[model samples]
Target: MLVAQSSDVSTDLGVYLPLVVMFVVAAAFAVGSALLGPLVGPSRYNRAKLSAYECGIEPSPQPVVGGGRVPVAYYLTAMLFILFDIEMVFLYPFAVSADVLGLFGLVEIFLFIATVGFAYAYVWRRGGLDWN
Candidate 1:
């Protein structure tokens, strides 16, 4: 049993080694691009290039003085979509293995759908489904 456990650990580590290497390479590439951009990029500095413009019109020279707040409804809608999408992703795998999982799987899937439905109802009641 001890020997088998050690072998499993070693095998798992081998399986994960490629994943670690891929992550390291991706990180290195991103960091290299960020670092090398300014170093190798253009050295010109001009007002036209640096100034912020909107729709080809120069913005107001005078800065506006006002408090600003973002709408939470947009974020709530996005989060709800992501939550439901992930639930569907889990459902597909369970469906493929339904025969093997049998009665236990059916009960679990029903419970999952019920929970998601409750959340959907709550969001609907809170007006997340409304597009103002």
Candidate 2:
């Protein structure tokens, strides 16, 4: 009937028409703001402001050969820190799901801890942990 056809058209338009309108409005606003900013902003360029700033340390003169080489141990320590940090992050989700996962979760977490511990011990034995 006419009523049924009218209801169907209204239902479809109600869902999709608002979404289309919102998308168009948001896109227009974003583009308008971006384009308007440069026009209204001040245009002043100076040497001090233009120079690369590094937290008020004053940019150091770069050596021709990338300055002196850094120690490998510093990099190794950073890598180890990142690895353990990631492991800790993964543990949180496992801990939250522990109840649902039951003893399997416990076994898996314990195995993970043991593996990480073994790696740490090996590194310690190899003097990777030593600062000197």
Candidate 3:
């Protein structure tokens, strides 16, 4: 019994050895890259290099209006994107495994879709999708 347990422990360790090694290598590489970047990279700083870049558009020194406050529309659009993106992320795995999950999964997914659809409808009704 003791020998059997010892062998099983050794077998488990053997199975996990490659995974452990991979994590160690990944950590070492990330640390090495971070430490080497500043030493190897250019030290020179100029106006162009230091200036905030916005897809080739020059950043305004001050807000054109409203004391530099950003529009709520931008945040609303971002939240909507995140909501739908998370919905898709949940959907993909279920779609791939739908056949194995059977009727219960179908019902659950319908419920999930319905919930998201209600949110979408609410947003549409409130003119969240309107550009202006």
lDDT of 3 by residue, 23-52 (tens): 999999999999999999999999989998
The full ranking of all candidates by TM-score, starting with the best, is 3, 2, 1
Give me the runs in candidate 1 sitting further than 4 Å from their true place: 1-16, 36-66, 85-100
User: Candidate 3, TM-score vs. the true structure?
Assistant: 0.69
**TM-score for each candidate, following the candidate numbering:** 0.52, 0.54, 0.69
Worst 10 residues of 3 by lDDT: 62-71
| Candidate that scores best on lDDT | 3
TM-score leader: 3
- What is the Cα root-mean-square deviation between model 2 and the actual structure? 7.5
- lDDT, model 1, position 93: 97
lDDT of candidate 2 over 51-107, digit per residue (tens): 887656667677437745677988999998998899999899998899998988899
What lDDT does the true structure give each of the candidates? 0.88, 0.87, 0.92
Per-residue lDDT of 115 in model 1: 94
Q: What does each candidate score in C-alpha RMSD?
A: 5.4, 7.5, 4.0
Per-residue lDDT of 1-132 in model 1, one digit per residue for the tens?
436688788988999999999999999999999999999999999988888866555577776577234578878889989999998998999989999999999999999999999999998998889999
